[model samples]
Target: MSTEKKTKINGINFRTDIVCYNKIGKPILLIECKSQNIKINIKTFDQLINYQSSLNANYMVITNGNKTICFNIKNNKINLIKKIPLYREV
Candidate 1:
């Protein structure tokens, strides 16, 4: 991540928890890490969803060390997925 780019998402300035980029420096995975005590809910998912318009990451993930959730974007629509694709699959 750079200080210049990706600093503002959806017009709101905030730092992302974790972002995994590919060789070309395109954001492939956007993750939001939370404490185990924090419930994984719509609000948590929304946080990552809010980044889509700006980041355009292919996958969105939220994990709290105990449980993990993953979603994939296709045709500009978001869908919950059972497994995340490997780098080659992307």
Candidate 2:
């Protein structure tokens, strides 16, 4: 797991909170964390969404300490995932 995952969008870079890699070193999971004061809303998902498309990660997660949402990225779409997969499972 790497805490500083960098991805670029329109020439600007964004840093993710956590990123997990697959056996081949390709990104598999991307997680964005926010302080309790930050609300988990559409805006909170922006970074995760950008990383998923750029890194082509299989999963994306966004949390604001109080609430968390998991997503499975498939065919360029984000779908809700019921649970977070273990490292070995990914």
Tell me, by lDDT, which candidate is best.
2
lDDT of 1 by residue, 1-90 (tens): 332244586577977787778889998988788899999988987777887667899998888889998888999888899876787876
lDDT of 2 by residue, 50-90 (tens): 77778788988888878888888777778998877788876
TM-score of each candidate? Answer: 0.83, 0.88
| Residue pair clashes in candidate 2 | none
Model 2: weakest 10-residue lDDT segment is 44-53
- The 10-residue segment with the lowest total lDDT in model 1: 1-10
Deviation (Å) of 73 in candidate 1? 0.3
- Candidate 2 TM-score over all chains jointly: 0.88
Model 2 residue runs over 4 Å out of place are none
- Report, for every candidate in turn, its global Cα lDDT versus the true structure: 0.79, 0.82
